[model samples]
Target: MATDDLNKPLGLPRERKAHRTPLVALVAPPLLIAIGLIAFFAFGDGPDDPGNVVAAIDDTSPDQTGSVGPALTPVYEAQSEPLVEVKPTGGLREVRGNDVIISDPSKPRPIRLAAAPFEDLIEADENGLLPRIGDDGTRPLDAYARPAGATEGMKRIAIVVGGIGIEGEAGQSAIASLPGEVTLGIVPYGEDLPATVAEARALGHEILLQLPMEPYNYPDIDPGPNTLTVAGGTAKNLDRLRWLLAQTTTYVGVMNYMGARFTGDDRALAPILGDIADRGLLFLDDGSSARSRVGAFASDSAPVIRADLVLDGDTAPAAIDARIKQLVAIARERGYAVATATAFPSTIARISAFARVAEENGIALVPVSSLVRADGS
Candidate 1:
């Protein structure tokens, strides 16, 4: 009977025991929860999240293995020189020291002729139709450039740079990477379009003026410091355009930079297109607008060539590479492809490297205008 009473007298120890049980129970649930959370995070399906999909498929390409698109084949070449001979100092017609008349035949004696189309005046505008006489007298400057297919053994690639806004270290370096025979595009309103064009020309790259016009955002969009706007009336607009185009001495043609409003206005652009034709220059419409009047107007008015693709619309290195491959494929398929891409460190490097690949694949990079003749067959 006394044993039960003695056990009951340990009241302080009993109370401590009761408090310890609840504390242990309370702590166990939280500790277990923390461990479960760590396990879930460590082995969870995180990669399957929507945020990772872009990273996964960003660089994927159908022809990732470097297979060419179509076999290249020859389309055309010059049979004979197409330039006309002009005599200097020999009479009413003469032949002076390297000087000859490049005047248009359509005009009368010192007359006014509708300056022949860009392709037609090739021999006249740039020093009077002598065809850059080689010592052998066999070179043909007026002859059509030969069009070729991307066969198993052809190696040619056109390198194109679309945007050149201002002269920074990065811009200079990007321009410097272009190889011989590559084509370059410069902004007509850049800090120094003339200097940039001349520099590119000296390096043996063909040049084009990237014209700025109204974009989708219109008044809201600043197309650099100088842009051709509809509100400026046709005459002022034309004058501004002409001045911009003239700023670059090296450009062989002009291409649209971005034009949402102008592209929709056939009536306003018709005369501008006519002027482009009148000036013996080609026009390239960068595919910025689905309702572009430039292409149709060009077909009817001048030697117009529109850009097929903007290669670096998305500037990721891998994306640029895929687009380059796609352009190559398209060029091979149609015997020629014309694309424009902005100048970026990654894009320039990738394009410079791709030029080598193009040569290996027999895809020659040419001016956008060359494709018309290339695909004429």
Candidate 2:
């Protein structure tokens, strides 16, 4: 110990003093954190303070100067009337609020039938003019139907070439090439539908309104705009149906586009069929779904016609020809048959060729209206 002490510097302390942290350093961090939290709770934007939030302001309020301001009472509470007011356009009926009142059953007379829509057969609505049964006991079904050919004691076949107005060139070709006896079904969603329908009618083809309806694989396989669905209630579906009916005029009947699920449900289908019957229009079941309940609910006044076969299920020419042969056999066995097809080139060609030899083969090619049987025989 004495030797080590001798080696050490004379002015240096033998043991270093114990180190201590400054009091301010230890306390400052926690004090600063507490102060920051207190300041945030007291002065920050809280639930009660909605800073710079914009809301709907009442334009009619004199106090509001169209400047950004705090939200007043809810806009809905300040008003008790409907958002929009609808007035009645001149028609057979007058619109009072949402109700339609017929003016006089004897006063509004039926207009003369023509290629254009009959004025008495139309009722004006918010959407457009919709087809309606005339007050003088005239039905659109009878007015628009192509006169049926003599089918007594002979095999009858009605071929419906649908999907007209969808593809412009193809539709025009179908209208030009096919015989007038083959009914043309017009889709409402197509462009220039009125013109297309007018052209078809001018060419002596009877028209059917091809309405879009919900299929089994809906949403994934949508039928397009204004498609009536099973999930939509009766009121909503009827409104949609009216919108479709207003698309064009001079169609003899309504045929479903694709409606597997909708036709299977009696609750959903009955009201629509009833509405069609009340308006004096026929309903054609395309025979796409075996589970369809159309016949059960159809009215006696306007019977529904179910298709015997679909001619172009397989769009190949040979397949279509074979189906046509089968259709002839069905007509021979049942005395009458109704067949539907798309406006495909192959289908149009096959049908055009078959139509030439149909009378020679003892088959009378008739319009769809000729096949309507009330007894469902």
Candidate 3:
């Protein structure tokens, strides 16, 4: 493991979603004409639509893409500002004064991406929600995987911009702002998580579900509701996990959200990681904890990638830019590097700039899936 010396001045932090339309009822005069339609143009085939919305459960699995090539130490974000509401985007957790992250407390609106879900991989439950395991292959993690196209000797770096699907506009901005090679880790709590995922896939970005996990602080510093808790036991935790997994498809794997406590116990987490593997998905440790045991458990079984840096722990333009440079340096030294960051505007903007400049610096900006261990994960 690379020491924190790679970059320490600014870094580590944790994890949002975003979109909706207004509903306007039309009541004309003349015998009280009834013309009330939800003006909120709900896009095609969303979760709320009549048919079960399966993002990408194709019956025929996509052909196997080529393999893993390579590749953090940063702080999770600790924003102290008061929460505020953003119009259209709704309520948000403000950061960097003007920057915002999508916040989800109550049930969210069913977000639908402009693109259609890949149908072959779908298997609908009684509720018409496609969250169960599919027969054969066709898992979204495989069907929608972005090809790495790694060269023989190029220094590769994989970057995961998480906290997606939280704040409406920020999430969209992130999808548009960064290149598709940057893997997006979407939180399942978002009302439009599946939709955000659709947009991500449309743009050729690999996706990962940011599974909520118990931080050591427990209820004090919660990752979010329905988080897989240590007390939840394997049965309960797996049940909640399946629900989360059903929220979206067309991604490569699963990532952690403040899982310091949940990942500490070897026996406690083994079944969870094992299940993720069984689902034909990979596991990514965001590296929030230097002492996390995910590395050990995943080593023998799952296809996993751990973070080398938390890009926005400092949450400032200069600090974030500096972290990018540090990330580039690590990639050059190790042949590959992976870093995780929240969707703060500063982080997104800085990473965007770095992606443009990375190739010029002799570094290849690769997807998170590309960084999985070489054993054909």
Best candidate (score: TM-score): 2
Off by over 4 Å in 2: 1-114, 373-377
lDDT digits (tens) for residues 1-377 of candidate 3: 35634433356421212333233322233224322223223343233444221121111111111111110111223343222222222111122333333323332222112234467655566423442235665555555567776456788989898989886777778886677778888988788766677667665578888999898878999888779888998899977887777777666689999989888877678888988876667899997788678888665347777899888889999999888888888988889988999888878788877877777778887788767744566
lDDT of model 2 at residue 94?
29
Q: For residues 212-316, what per-residue lDDT tens digits would candidate 1 score against the true structure?
A: 887777778777645777676688877776566555443456777788787678776877777766555567777666788777765532667666677778889
Q: Rank the candidates by TM-score, best first.
A: 2, 3, 1
lDDT of each: 0.55, 0.76, 0.68
| lDDT over C-alpha atoms for residue 239 of model 3 | 79
How many residue pairs clash (N, CA or C atoms closer than 3 angstroms) in each of the candidate models, in the order given?
20, 0, 31
What lDDT tens digits, residue by residue, belong to model 2 across residues 1-377? 68548534688855555556599986898899999989866765344543313222222211111111221222222253212222222212222333222222432221112468888988899888787889997888877877765666779899998999986677788887787778889999888987788777755688899999999989899989999999999999999999999898988889999999999999999899988888878899999899988878755675698898899999999999999999999988988889999999888889988988887889887778766732532
- In angstroms, how far off is 306's CA in candidate 3? 0.7
* Candidate 3 positional error at 66, Å: 22
